[model samples]
Target: MVNRVEVFAAIRRDARVEGMSIRALAEKHGVHRRTVRQALEGAEPPPRKTPVRMSPRLAPFKSAIDEMLTCDLDAPRKQRHTARRVHVRLIEEHAATNLSYSTVRDYVRVRRAQIDLAAGRRNEVMVPQEHAPAAEAEVDFGEVYVILAGVKTKCRMFTFRLSYSGKAIHRVYATEGQEAFLEGHIDAFNEIGGIPTRHIRYDNLTSAVSKVVVARGHDPARDRVENSRWLLFRSHYGFDAFYCQPGIAGAHEKGGVEGEVGRFRRTHLVPMPVVDSLDELNEKIREWDLADERRRINDRIRTVADDFAQERQLLAPVPVEGFEPGLILTPRVDRSSLITVRMARYSVPARFIHRRVRVSLRASEVVVFDPDKSGRTQIARHPRVVTKGGQCVDLDHYLEVLKGKPGALPGSTALAQARASGVFTAAHEAFWANARRRLGDADGTRELIDVLLLHRHLPAAAVEAGLTAAISVGATSADVVALEARLHLAKTDAIAVVEHAGAVGGAGSGRHLVAQRHLDEQQDVARDVVAEARRRKVVSLTERLLLDPAAVIAGLPPDTRPLPSVEKYDQLLRLRTGTDNHPAPPTEQARPARPALSVEETP
Candidate 1:
């Protein structure tokens, strides 16, 4: 700016004092024609003018805008008005028709700082503290956006992060409820192998806090109290709770987990993770947790997993079996053998219809229980589904209904769901088709029902294998399929028992191998109960034969070879000497009694 001013002044002096023409000055001073004419005509480039303009349209609304901005100083930061919001208020409240958004924006931008200054604006300060090893942790919930089944969806993620090691656990949930909250903590404890000995910090989440009183002082204990269920959950796990203030103002209190949620979602869920089910998504979450073992913090010298290794040694061990955070609902099964939950249908057993049954709804599974004359039995369990109006059906649940209406079996929702889940295999379809051709529709459907009932007693894989074998051999009867199924179960079960026993001890003993052969010979419970007795009898008889081999040989038929007669020769010498033939036999030590064998026979 100074150089430009000096050059303009020099051009004017040369043009005026040297008596140079305007055209000559333009060429001599390297100035534009108009610049030389203006310089020659003006006095030292008349001081730059300051212009002032007035907007009559916005004059009436200025006071109202100032009032709104002043009121915003006392309101929550997030609730503060933007320039556009102020413009909208001006039009709606003040009837200011001619005011544009830009006019309000310019004024608000210029005057808002004065409003904040009058309200004493200050930046929040945070104190940094060193985290003790295995002494504390932070817990919080955050929203996570994911691509589920090609559809973009949002879910809540419960994050638990250790303060010392920066280790974290992330779990995605369809809903953020008390059960999911408690379950996340329990799972984190179980994963890390121990509970933090000191306090666990939490945001003032409704899941943990029932109310937050404003009268109490800085002590969180007096200001906020835990909900009844939350207190019970904390007591069961044997941990202390630390509550942050009830809003975004105290977010820094548990910022470790708050930041963890964002960090993990950005690192693992970027480029959008597409998964078919929540379980598959959680499996990927576990993989991310394992992968974090190799990651180091920004200024750390070692991996987070290594830091956790040190903190883990100081952690308090949790009990082997502990609390189960799940909701116990008593929802009656409808006529369709399905129960409505969260606006979706989940199948239970047909026998439970119209009857109130106990349903244990956990984070992942919906387990149903039915009461009978004997006791309560777990009838069925299905993965909890979140899709609205979606149905989760089991073929076994409708097998009894299918038997009465074979035509319905062909087009039942249960069968379709089973096929989609891959529980109803191609082998089942093949067997059903073949049976239909051989025995007609009704009888074939009944046969399929019988095969389905076998699943209650035998493993599904065994039953499927049996169906494949039966179809291959051209055996169409349900009895043939059942027999093959039982044979497979017996064979596989025997092998399992042998392998389990060998694993319990050493494999070189060969005792398990011998027992496996004996087990394969019979599958009846009564035979198994007497198998040990039979083994003892054979051993006892062999011992007696060895004790009196000469006498047993003398009693044998002539075709068999006889033992040596050493005892007879000793008897002949006694007879010649005429000594007491009944003299006491030379005393000898009795063989040590063998230890009793232990057997746990199946009833």
Candidate 2:
């Protein structure tokens, strides 16, 4: 009730300035004898500390309100009691009507803060955290925009960071789907040469989580369930996983990768790179990644690459088999040699039409295979297009059907694509014009189809070169085109032999002899093919095997017949020597015994 400063000042004035005696000051100040003695001895009086006052009316109520507030720590914020609720409960539960509502309200406010402090609800201050080398890492997806194929498109960068070394791996994807998520992990691990730690941290992404069922007041680990595919992937890589709290609360948990994605994007992907395809964009990204090895992170003397080099030994060795981050689908090939996957059409071989085939769909490519074969035969393959309703056609798949319907060759989609792809080159166009002059349109297109079919077994560039050579030599027949194509191809296909400083006398002589022999054989085959073409004789491919050795060899049946048994020779030896010493061997199947006759009886 009294100000300590003012009281001290009064003691000083009365004792020093007014010249009051100790007894007089005590009476004037209405103070104790000791207080007056202290005031007279010193210029100022020392203030006393007030004792903590206990409230009699609210003593019992304090415990009750504290009990309620303690549970409120875990209870929903909106469901917790207000001051009015506490006051009403006090009167009803403890018969505390004598206590005023304002007294309880004011007391409850201060008490709540004290209880919260006791319950670990104080304001936080962050301290530097140290990570164990190769013991932990973080994973996250960051969104970035770049000009892809001249179109500004949104993309996601899947980033993985080793917390201790500050080394990170990043891969860009069109979507952050589960396949991309798992594939990124595989690729990142491979780039690092091993898997970092056993535990990887994530931010409750749907790719890894099936559902986050619990909101508040529940443990995060118990509330969320891991996706089955994701679990299998983790098991395959032999790694444990941890999830961060939802939203911004968990941002600090995986802060390493969080900062890495932004830093990498700003440093490398800033100028909005324009690339024709994802492969091109990835190639640029790869170059930047390799070049980034020279830069250091923060004040560290060692570069990121240097730290990664040290950390590589601490990481777990990769598994024997790598995981295929792809979705398997069984799609039926359509009549047009096309199969629709994710609403996009990809062409397969026409022979597989109406048959179900297996498709391996990755982030940027689709590979189709014949299901009956154990992945030995790949029917068709195409780069995946991000946009729906896109179609990728391979002209070779339609060659056989085009051969029968040569009239459809001009207006067909396959022809247009072939022309654009340079598969149907200028040489082919020139040859076609010449063929049309010699033969009619129907016959000319058939010859073109024959040249196109050569592409199936040989490279298109070699075929185009052969067409150029054939056109130069004034050869209009398809057999001449085939012969010229083979000649150009043998030289192109020959393996390059590098000459060392000290070489043998004839290192490449064998290769030169092989090429000359191939040329002579091709010339003979060409003469036979031309003779067959010039005449009107209708010959099936099987009948003309004498012309093409490769077709003949391929058409030959397997030599599955059994060889004569050694028992027959044994019997001949016994009969010639007239010695019955060796016993006849038992046979697997029953046969009738032949009647014996003397050699001279018939004569």
Candidate 3:
């Protein structure tokens, strides 16, 4: 059962050590005399020759098959004949009815390559690469599935990996379009704190490639037409893009990232990630990226982080001005207070209904802008709706209109969505119910709407706390709720200010005492201000004018008339009081009287 090499070794050892004759070796090893002689001549056995089988049935068609293969040389790579096609053609054209398909297929396979070789067409070869630190990087999108909001959803993982360090930044996006593509680069650049100096390797993704302009015979990368937005993005970041050739031929060009995407997916995203949103999934990916810094790739000597530290400094500094990676659209707000972006509807302020609003559709969110004399102002922001016909509504946007139609508040879609999202909390519901019981449905709903409006000027937590406080005190008035919210906000601000002052005022030595004293004085001033604000009466415009007419007039223009004085009437008051013996004499006599005309005389 010994192998040939072992047999040869044994034969050589026995022949040399025992000095046995050829006939004796033959007798001992059970081989013929000539075989023994050959073994004695050389310890190593000669390689066994492979017999070339002559196919009688296929020999007649060999010339035809060669001609077909030769003609295939000029044909498009994909349009060339397969082994099966060659077999079929031989039977059909030459009437080689008895030819086995396997014989014709095998002959065609070897003969085709021989023809191609003679014609100077060769298979592609991959060269091993040694990457320089911070010189180059690769970007790619890997498809992954995640349980998003309890639904199995497909997402794209955008990966940007440094060639040398293998430090990667990953982001999950709902779409792999141009906006997400650009945004991925921005996020990676910001995370790495710089850009790769040479170029980033990428496949001709549609996001970056307008078209592959080359014919099949030409080099795809050289003849590609770059996308305008992609060109602008590359110019802004000051990096070059080295697109891989189209299809499988180009896949090996960015092998680093191609392998990296699979590796990361297997390592981190193996168990399909469960997340409420893409943002959450991306957050987890970022954490995984940080953890990956300690890992080594292949036979690397240092950790990913160690190599990245050295490479980081060599990278080009990122530009100061940030790029907006969102797609801008001007959508007319529909009558339902919604604006449609990419087939999904998102609610804007009710006032924006029937008006054209500018929307910035980003990877994770939709932001609507309202333009005025003061410039563009952000009116609403909602998490992007991924599916068509989906809607994202904000209760606050409809609160103003709902105030007028209080009954609608009970069954409005916006309110339901608000409740589902925990924006309308238990405290809010409690306050609303209490208000309804105390004030009846219409007035109570109006009060709830007013409380909701408080969110515009106050923090949500403060407003919620205010609602809870008001409910505890059996107060259904929106004013009382607003007052309570302000109180909560003031408390929070005071605590924050005091903590900030303490932080700014350092510790150690007599200087600390001085800082503490200054802080105390600041606290005293703040308390006095708060007390003054609390004690001051809240008044309407009319009451303020009656109480302090001078103050109001002082704010008026210089050309404005002065307010009339009541001092002239004080003389009459003095006579009535008997404090002054002023003349009450010039009554009707002193006053000039006008003559009366009788219109009835003419009639």
Better of 1 and 2 by TM-score: 1
lDDT comparison, 2 vs 3, better candidate: 3
Order of the predicted models by lDDT, top scorer first? 3, 1, 2
Q: List the residue pairs that clash in candidate 2.
A: none
- Backbone clash numbers for all candidates listed: 0, 0, 0
RMSD to the true structure for each prediction, in A, is 15.6, 16.8, 8.9
CA RMSD (A), model 2: 16.8
Better structure of 1 and 3 per TM-score: 3
Q: Model 1, 277: alpha-carbon shift in Å?
A: 2.6
Weakest 10 consecutive residues of candidate 3 by summed lDDT: 536-545
TM-score of each: 0.68, 0.63, 0.80
In candidate 2, what are the lDDT values of residues 373-393, reduced to their tens digit? Answer: 897488888887667897888
Worst 10 residues of 2 by lDDT: 495-504
lDDT of 3 by residue, 210-329 (tens): 888877787657677888878888999899988887878788888989999999999988899888888888888889999999998989899999999999999999999988888889
Q: What lDDT tens digits, residue by residue, belong to model 1 across residues 418-515? A: 88878888998898988888778999888888988888888988898789777776566677777777766766665566555455445334657766
Candidate 3 residue-pair clash tally: 0
